[model samples]
Target: MRKPRDYDSELKALELKARQLKSRRQSQLGELVIATGADALTSEELAGALLAAVTTHDHAMKEAWRKRGAGFFSGGRPGAGDSAGREPGGAASGAGSTPPPSSEPGAA
Candidate 1:
């Protein structure tokens, strides 16, 4: 006759693996915060800033941010202009100055 499987041990191992993965994810997120220099902000301030960025609806603004983020992930330094064909702030201003305010209400 075949022996019974140790289901309890298997369940315990799976639970431990899940906990380890969750801890690693939290650690990685902390590293990202520090890398971005956002660790200087209070938790509330960081959360608010992230909320604002994520909730922005301007397509051009989102694209600009996307390119910057991609560059960061691709090991390109910030402000390196890797986002071909678009000069920094050139989309909104003639002299690469700050972009104009979005038409969206409550946008900064």
Candidate 2:
């Protein structure tokens, strides 16, 4: 009767107070952990959200890795396929075949 109703109100008040305290303490509270009454989101929603985050992070990481890789080759921007053009001494770039030692060494 009245006792049961009072207990319900007290429980509701305590739950609300705890939620308020938690919200005040956390910055990511803007994102909801659960709905008030609706069923939890489906696996599809969770997967899609996770994929979007991964794709964004992956793209950013790839751009950074590319920049670092380009820097490794040129110490600056790598030109239009210039990394494949030629070496400093113009030997078709890359670790080319090391030429054999000269045989006619001072005619000796």
List the global CA lDDT of all models. 0.66, 0.48
Model 1 residue runs over 4 Å out of place are: 57-63, 78-108
lDDT of 1 by residue, 1-108 (tens): 999999999999999999999999999999877654456567898899799899999999889888777777778754223332465532322322222223344473
Model 1 TM-score? 0.60
Tell me model 2's lDDT, rounded to 2 decimals.
Answer: 0.48
- How much does candidate 2 score in TM-score? 0.22
* Model 2 misplaced regions, further than 4 Å: 1-5, 28-108
What TM-score, over all chains together, does every model reach? 0.60, 0.22
- Tell me, by lDDT, which candidate is best: 1
- Which RMSD values do the candidates have, in order? 12.3, 24.0
